[model samples]
Target: MSQFVCVRLIQGNGLDLTLFQFDYDLTFAAFFLNADRTLYGRYGTRSSLKEAEADMSLAGFRDALAAALKLHAGYPGNREALAGKQAHEPRFKVPEEYPALREFKLKLDYEKKEFNGCIHCHQVRDAERRLLRERNEPLSDRDMFPWPIPDLVGLALDPEKRATVKSIADGSPAARAGFRTGDDLVSLSGQALVSTADVQWVLHNANDGAKLPVRVKRDDREATLMLELPTGWRRAADVSWRPTSWDLRRMATGGLVLENLTDDERHEAGVADDKLALRVKYVGQFGAHAAGRDAGFQKGDIVIEYDGVSKRLTESGLFAHATQVRKLRDRIPITVLRKGERVKLTLPMQ
Candidate 1:
């Protein structure tokens, strides 16, 4: 479950303001700061008084909280009352996946210190590749076409010596920057890749559209390639082993195009297959409610066929129909599987 808390702020110079409310279970502190860096308002999520006091003393936590409060004030709403603004966004970056918490915890593991930097650096690199692939961008081809990137962790490879490269997708920023397949990624933005964490550390903090310096090893020669960051893009090829429904939701563009399911998705969709495939899960009750209660569907129903074609929901003509032919709130007939039994439901296009 998610908790949303609103801060009540009083306008004053950094310090002359009142301390607002705090939530304990979620581990957050919300408040405003002045241009000089002194905090004005206050809110926190520490469960204990000591914890709250200590968190307030940390430079990192204080900086983060101060920034959150300031950003919260500028949103398309009033700030004096600060009744509805929330504090969840900056409290965590990449929270849903590839979270910093795990990377942070791994950095402090005393038993793993010897491997910490190297191990996490590669993890970062892998995540970067996954990001590129998900955006349908090709790997940087430093050597030639059809670059082969082996699974680093699975292959028990040495992080510092191991190299993985992909052919940069055509018409992408990487491609525009002249990257090609077989190009070995030696470093990012001038920082050498020594561990998984290093890659993650850099990418996590990079500006969305900035040009990043990449040193590549091509044809046994090292060269530097300036690659532009492609924001909010993923590789197109199928590589997900257990793609979440969340991943599918992210893939939708102008129209729904279903992705091949990951292993877990196949199981959830009641299909047993080794190859990646995509399937439809229920468009939740909340979604139905948004559909004006005319959405001819209910929870727990799996879309089986759309427009007489037996295909995945994102791939079905029915989905396209929703995008093009159907008007908002228009009712349409759809066939689904409910508890292993076929059922026809008419849901309003929403």
Candidate 2:
């Protein structure tokens, strides 16, 4: 009665590194592939690290599995259609090959406590960024913004339906491309859409200001549209909600979790709503991340300005400034409101 066979991989050992490709931050993921290593589709997505199922669902997984099976039935004949969905040659062929991870004693056995000895998924991304940082290379937008979300292009997809348009943001690239709510996305930039992650894959490969061809099934009809991406569009995605953002926090703010003050809070603090007022929500207490704490930063401090400038307000914006404009170990002046008084302190960039 069942047409599908499922195999669960509880460990990363003996996994073919070349065939399986996905976001390192993913908690649960599935890669449908042929025995020959041809990738069919992927099913897993997450927007918020705090919420494991934020952008995934059983309905979506079912649709993706069904789609993969359909593609399999077509077999080699449909290979051309799925060409763009294939994984690219990775920078590192295997986890053990990564220079940053070579020193760690990694074990792949899931049954043992040493299962923790295995290289975690996020480590790959962390290692990549660390490699760039160690090389003293400027972090490019792609390095800073890996795995661009569909929201960057103004498309909000339904988590319950594979590749279905849940909503279109006003004046977004999707809206301009004539995308409508309830439309089933068929392909993006010549790649067949199997899951939300597939869409993100396409977007991740897309260049800024590139015009992408989008095909969607609207009702019983199919139509093609062009989604024109503008420059700096990837910045629209907020990085604060990601679990990997902790690494970013360490790099940019020296382990300070910052949040913009609410209007009421700002008013009570006598700060204008339009001004930069980032509250120190949490300060790292130990290790390399504790540079802010070491610099005498305390909890509940409201940072009003950095380096004689107060234009950047959001944490992400401030981080961009710190990592991009300022050099590492740069001692910068910071103004913070502490216990009903303005206090100035020199903070060193880590």
Candidate 3:
């Protein structure tokens, strides 16, 4: 640890959005860069709050540091190859500069144990989405779900190791691309890998129907594969796990918390596996959150269909569908099962 200088940034008050781009919801993240601002790679990855540590490990971090030192030694000669790893042109220079967050201060008062004016990492995301929503612009896939984990396309990496494939989901894009267990991911889309977070950075910028070049080391031989992302692949990402979903709930479902029915619950409810059978777990009762309650939605109602779509969708998927397909204040036709009788309702988009 004494070999390199470490700087810890605990607040997002004056964060340079132009340079430090990453998953804002992550509890921990790191970047490796030369003195000249040439970034080597990034570290830190997480899916849900409970599993924040599942995708990262100290041993993996050590390996990444070693890899960064190796890259530093090769510096100018390898600068071009590191080009793809740098952040793209930013929309905003800093968190406070965002249209929705202009009221926040650029710095905090250190003497105060708690700075009420301080901006958090997650607020950066919330502010961006708010700006877009205020402009009545449709949110993109990346906005709805940012920094998708590797498992979305199906590659489970070991936390204690750097980019080592631990398992592959059956019939997934990774498997289709010929990714095998125990293979070490070397690079993706021309950028060298340092940790699982780097892999996500590549995926975050990728668009629909994109084919990404990937290289892996298997049995001491390197092999290349094309990761084919089909249309609507980003819809698989579940945003309910993110803290930002709280705002989404107000904007879409009117603060109604929906939960998917279990296997046994579905069977008893006569709902098929592929059908929509989400139960209304809770309905907010005040201000903007009271829209769900005012719309005639009950806590125990089982949602069978929404907006003429009947296929299964998680709460996050429902938010994505509403955001992409329906505009704000659009009344959606919905059917729910209440007390063994089918009831029709209208959910207003906030």
CA lDDT of each prediction against the hidden true structure: 0.38, 0.80, 0.88
TM-score of each: 0.30, 0.91, 0.95
Model 2 pairs in collision: none
Q: What is the lDDT of residue 53 in candidate 2?
A: 82
lDDT of 2 by residue, 85-105 (tens): 888887776666667778655
After TM-score superposition, the amount by which residue 334's alpha carbon in candidate 2 deviates from its true location, in angstroms, is 2.9
Q: In model 2, which regions exceed 4 Å deviation?
A: 1-7, 11-17, 110-113, 270-274, 307-309
Candidate 3 TM-score over all chains jointly: 0.95
* Local distance difference test, candidate 1: 0.38
Q: Least accurate stretch of 10 residues (summed lDDT) in model 3? A: 109-118
Better of 1 and 3 by lDDT: 3
Q: Which stretches of candidate 1 lie over 4 Å from their true place?
A: 1-161, 166-172, 195-197, 234-350
Q: What is the lDDT ranking, best to worst? A: 3, 2, 1
Ranking by TM-score: 3, 2, 1
**In model 3, which residue pairs have backbone atoms overlapping below 3 Å?**
none
lDDT of 3 by residue, 1-350 (tens): 66677999989998998789999888889999888888999999888778877788899999888888888899889887699999888889999999878998888877865558878888899888878777778899999989998899998888788789999999999999999999998889988888898889999999989999999999999999899988878779988878788878888889899998999998988888999988999999999888999999999999999898889989888888787788888899999989878899998886
